[model samples]
Target: MSTVAQPDLAVLSSPWTLGPLHLSNRVVMGSMHTGLEVRDDGGAAMAAFYRERAAGGVACIVTGGIAVSDEARGGPDFAVFGADGADERFRVAVDAVHDEGGTVLAQLFHAGRYALVQGVTDRHGRPQRAVAPSALPWAAARGVVPEELTGDEVRSTIEDFAAAARSARDIGFDGVEIMASEGYLVNQFQSPLTNHREDEWGGTPERRRRFAVEVVRAVRAAVPDLAVTIRLSGADLMPGSTTDDEVDALVRDLLPLGLDGVSVGIGWHESRTPTVQASVPHGAWVSYAERIARVVRTSDHPDVRVIASNRMTDLRDGETVLRDGLVDAVALARPFLADPDIVARSLGGRFDLVNTCIGCNQACLDRSIVGAPVSCLVNPRAARELAFPARPTRRALRVDVVGGGPAGLAAAVDAARRGHTVTLWEADASLGGQFALAAAIPGKEDYAATVRAAVAELADRGATVHLGRRAAVADLAGSDAVLLALGVVPRPLDVPGADLPHVVSYEQALREGVPAGTVAIVGGGGIGVDTAAFLVESPDEVVRAAEFAERWDVDVARDVLGDVPQRLPAADRVTRPGPEVTVLRRAGKIGQGIGITSRWVAVGRLRDAGVHLVAGVRAYLRIEPGTLWILDEAGVERAVPADHVVVCAGQERAPGAEETGPDGLVANLRAAGVPVAVVGGARDASGVDAVRATSEALEAVRRLAP
Candidate 1:
């Protein structure tokens, strides 16, 4: 196997030209909807978000897809370019990026069928119907059929694109990128499955390509001096959708029409392919970009560069692809959310200190999908960056943080950084509490990265960490403040036979191997789902290799001959034929806390592993011998044969931990004349995760010292 070296910082940070615009680095911040824009002001929160990334050393920043026309918008929160007072609202954002030596581009978008089906409203608060080349119902759009655009409507939409580009240019944006990918209006017209129109705007490849080509031509003409780029789906991945050959032809036809560059966005909203999930191998889509780059390389307009996107997490992977001539620039969206200064840190050779994105979409894309501001699970201060500045404490004081989990680690680090003498104690031999168990889950080793980062941060910030040492409340008597981040313990099952030898907690199942047989997992929450994934063995390497080759349409023989690594490491890959697992949930849904962005992937994996999911079980009658009795929602009793039962019902607060209210731990501690704070799962039985733990810890430390 060929070993890829560490990224050459000099090469990565070198200045590169994208058509007429010069970038200080080859890194482009991929545009992602943050849901941070102030509806009244153009992009107040959006500007702050981008400015932070620009200051962190990103070469160019692409603003989230700005709605070009009110009729084509997703929601009131979406940035509008041609709307009233849009220029004034957008000027501040453009200036903010420019001030930080980063070129900003406005991404013009029309969500089309998605917007209508999503019930997206216009400025007047009326539901905006989606328009497309043909009246097709996208599965994601539920049952809503998009209104097929008349030829006149199509032409006007093209004008809307041009006008939006002009507005962006007028607002002092460096460029404008037309959103032609991801099942949007433009992509709808380009796809054979979506655009079944027999008119000039569809049918033949040239006709289907007309809408995109026209939009690019019109936008380029409207904003002659501004750089124009189109975000294209290298392959839509949808059934009977636009193929690579079609995309190549489309690119060839569009490049000659004054296109400056193309940003490759892989897959559509409805595609079966996994594009940007954590389970996806790093640089999985680099091959798609390479194909597009090769096409651009031989095109009549070779000046147009290919920007590789979709799961480009780290500079090492980005550098490898760039070195291999796959892409001219690597575009990252989530990584910047995890570490805004990722580029600067890489350039300075502080790679270890760089908090890499774990691709857990829980906070970032998941929140955005629900119309909330995008944040990071690992980095608490993502969209709310300004809110978390670690200012000096009012005075130096001794601080004791109980538990060395994410919460304790964050509090200790932040408190120490604020000039407090901080000590963190964990009862276990290591820092990570539940996170360690989380890391042990198959395909979830990235959680370990969060623990590693926290540990490093604690050490760097001069926090004393004590492992295998249990600190009592009495031990914190002399401390000026105490933070109890004592994590959660498994909630025991209340039914009969819960104490059987085969009945184990989810933690035990994750930490230790379960007996190989029919295993039943109780609770379909995140832990239950994860435990099921952990217990089930993945398909063997030979099976996985065949599946991969089939998924990507690669030749297995050629792949083997090329020395491609087909077998996954024992630590990372899943195994099959290991255990017959069934997940039982009292609730109607499974993986409730799992984010929508990743829940499907987890469920899909479970399905592929042949794990049975049974929901709406009203009662667990009992467990006897090798059988478990459960009552269904309809009051029917069913006997499920199980060799072992794993309980993942949920977590409860640790013993003696108080609530988060005024009369909680802090109040009681203060009543005893000792300053105190509380954070993590110890503070609340519900609403506990890494993001919450970390953010609450930072806030608690700041409030304690303030």
Candidate 2:
């Protein structure tokens, strides 16, 4: 009943306003399905889930696909309405958001033919079919005809929208957005391939636009100041679907229907519409938004605002789109997940160190698909905010951390932030270790960005970072305690030809580009073949492309491979350092540990390029400077040409020794001679946990406290 004051500074600085409400910033939190929504009965998560994102300072927080009617929900985990009753859970949500000085919007959706019912007496379940215009299945399905909707059913659907809008308003929501993109029910009706009816709702573009137009008008008429948002898909990428022209026309119609605003996005990562790969630059959708703004300006439409999102993790990208007049506001999803304080940081214009979202979609999307709670990959403290808020710490003892790699850095930063005097020692001059190399490869730059962010977080937390410091047991002598994060060293190939001068490890090959001529790789693991491909695609860009393509052709038999070879991301993003490499192999599968998407792309290119792949060959001897002998799996030795041999075998760690560390050795000094606890890969098979600067370290520190 009382008014809550918004952040005074943010509101005054931002130029955008809707009704009497003023936006402190143009950033809006886009909706994502948090698999975390699953409740005990396999329903949505407790009310606490939505409350945190609001608490985390989202200007406007949207829900994971909440359905207009029960049937539209994909699962019970989706936010669903009960018959004619208010959602009491929203009271807590509204208060939590208001406490944080933010607004909340409910996204009203209908999964349409996509919905399935599994609860309570088998329910209305997919309806033995659906009410699609024609029969068009989406992303995970080939085209199929949906059950046609009767006129009465259509009328009920419209009424359902009205009821849902009223429910949202009654529940203290600032607004509701009609999801009209990404191959959902509404998009299906609006798409030609999916809609084949001759009725008033499906004949021409105008008829097809009728359903959405009616829904918007009904909702707007129901709640005049309810902030009605209709999210539009710029390019659905399906045949007979809406195009830019159709989009322009649809906007002309939908605008006059009393819409509060339109939020625009692209593609169907999970749906049936075509999706562009992550290779597409960040904020690639801005051009489309700019085009939408242009159309609005030239049209005789109402004074409506536009909200656009997609790859908006970078604040500059958000600022650029806003400044360029592409859209009225910028919406983001992964950025806020990566760093909840991004808005506060960006207001400071410290964009470079803002903990960027690399569009990996792994932690954000992949985890949600498997029904896990959504969070950032690098920031483990998110999604568990209620249980573990990022609190200011109490001062503790000084501690030393060895090895500034991923694991070490993660532990160090967390400890330092928890009020420990942390000093991190790296053998190399720079922080990123093997991760740096992995990130340098094509399709791996995201990992590199992750490492950079980690280093920044460590330094910000007051960790003393010592580069070029090859730490040993002596480094921890002066510390209250030591966290030995010694990483693995490269393995040696004791094979006969390893001693030859041309022999190199993949790491060595990276710094000094692989020399011209033939190459032979000894390992068949993930790193081995990946590095080999990069070596073959090295420095001589044009010639390397031809040779790399030609090698695969020659190996697969030139005509068998034909004229087309796959493209390398390296060719587009950066120039490689070496020459056109021809590779010879011992025996192994090429794609060992690459992700489903990365492996498929990488292997397809090499196989298409005709690179000769010989498996099960045993290396015999380096007989000549430019030649080597290899015994076939059949026991006959044959000669192969090799200008260089690279070993790809993995490394070793003696956790065996670390566990049963020699009496009174470095690890035993803690807890009046209680040995260190090491979990994860660092722990022994005994299940002892690793020492954390907070929990584990603080626990140990408590024992010694006065």
Candidate 3:
């Protein structure tokens, strides 16, 4: 394998100092909740999770939200300061990172109204009511209203932040970061939409900013020797919330409060705009950080570092921003989850070996939103680092991984990395399988990058990949173990005229180009919605950062001093019009199987693109030369006119098994006394997704690997 050309990352590689803390580079591992803190192993799991990333090459690691008090805790999994063994957990994690020559900062957090979950308890083991600046019901929390914090309670919360910071210093943490962004307790007080208080905590802009100001003052005074930073919302994105000027003012006030750094966070949790989802372009939120950086640069504390964060998965992009001198550093959260060694790989010019975060949010953010243990879709060993240790095998064996999809690639790499000789087979001319088709969708270019990374990793691990070869039972019989990741075949449309030339499979439409005329997409699942989004855009418009910003009306080109525009001005371009696309579903929601975090963004993109969506279809009746017929839920037959009928209904197991049905391949291999493991869509296509496929592949290798 040839070494890839390296981009100049001089600025990103430069050492920097933040107050009392010194970092090796400008890259920081931003905080993310992995639900490993509450584990019974006294933070062993969480320590391993941090140590792996720290060793991978992050200059500093920001620990996930550590609640200051019982009322501030987001949920039961949130590590609280006074909780039993909390200091021990902090000490373990800090010591582990320090052992790897890495610095870690504890992020003091308060969930505010977001902690409406039932499990949150107080010191006396009684259910604690979620507290906020005012007694308002969060829109997403149904009708449950948070109790307004009394003046005394609010002051106590300030003391809580101070105590947490003091505890972090005692635990050997390098620093402490106050989480004031993302609609948390401090952010809630800053926004009028949530803070209806008439006291000094609200009423006016300066008063509204008082809560955060006092918290900063308290925390800084408590740990004067520690490197203290605050994560501030650059733009809340919520209507009737803190204006950009007000947020800037808050930053100005906080800078004078003896802060070391400011990490800019974008959007509120309830904001309609997409912040971290895949559809959001890489570096879309950097401008907000730039805005804050400008303020910090002009302030008395010009030495304070400002970190650009959100939607920054690529280090090259981070280097670009750093080179431009817009911000002092770049903090990436989910990308580290996807590839712990993202910095090392990119620095070595082995970008192809870096598993890029596709921004799918399937496993990480989606699970974190529901308090589930957060892992990665591409790398399932993220939080399970200790369990899936990559120790070289004492006795390496021959391993055959059939099908070059994500599952097969993962298995091949895992086996090869374990010192086993691995051989991978793919019937297609190239690898990627369905991911290649997915990459054709404008916003999903990273899906192709994922495949490239997997392929590169396989080669780097000394695994042999045979393209355009279907390994039969005979071909695999001699292997010590055969891992079947044969993937899935598109479930055929079983209606009349289904074989018509105008009726194309979803794969065909994605792999090849759809017709220029109208398109009626059958099945409003993830694939169907993706196809609709693809067909509704011009071929040349690949939905990169600039184009996405334009389409979403984010006024990125506005003058820095001007009040940030809520929407961008229209720009006319001469280009071919897209096809008229309509997505149909029999039942359930469109993009049904997509992760909760990304489904809305996908559906929103379709709607914004003028794609028609039809649900409650009783049945797909038939396909004509230029139309598709469907039975509506109203018991009426509907004719959807279209030049192309794309079927994305779903998929079934690949026809790898012969006489013994779907299990024939496994049965045959077992009959020949060969070890066999079936995974991915080959094992079961029903509700099969990338997350499940890669996760199953790891489990199979864990069991099969010696």
**Number of the top lDDT candidate:** 3
Candidate 3, residue 693: CA error in Å? 0.7
Best by TM-score: 3
Of the two candidates 2 and 3, the one with more favorable TM-score, higher being better, is: 3
- Write the residue-wise lDDT of candidate 3 on 180-286 in tens digits: 99999999999999999999899999999999999999999999999999999899988789999999999999998999999999888988888888777667777
Clash pairs of candidate 3?
Answer: none
Could you list the CA RMSD of all candidates, in the order they appear? 3.4, 8.6, 3.9
In candidate 2, which residue ranges exceed 4 Å CA deviation?
1-13, 40-58, 83-90, 113-135, 138-151, 270-278, 394-399, 443-446, 470-503, 517-657, 661-706
Candidate 3 regions with alpha-carbon error over 4 angstroms = 1-6, 538-544, 557-579, 657-663
lDDT of each: 0.78, 0.60, 0.84
Winner on lDDT (1 vs 3): 3
Identify the superior model by TM-score, candidate 1 or candidate 3: 3
Q: What 10-residue stretch in candidate 3 is worst by lDDT?
A: 569-578
What TM-score goes with each of the models? 0.91, 0.76, 0.95
lDDT of 1 by residue, 1-706 (tens): 0125664655567788887898888999998887665445455666777788999999888888888788677655676765556677679878888899889998999988777435566667777777778887876566778888998999999999998888888789999999999888899889988889988998898899999999999999998898889999888878788877999999999988888889988888877776677766556666777788989999777878899887666687677667765478889998998888889878887666677787888888777766776778777768875566545777899988888877777677667767888888888999788878888776566667768767876677787888897775566778887888888899999989998999999888777768667888889988989888777734233344345546556332221123335555455433334237888899768888887778887788787767888899999999877878999889999988688899998888775456445435554566678877667788786856877887787778777765
Which ten contiguous residues of candidate 2 have the minimum total lDDT?
553-562
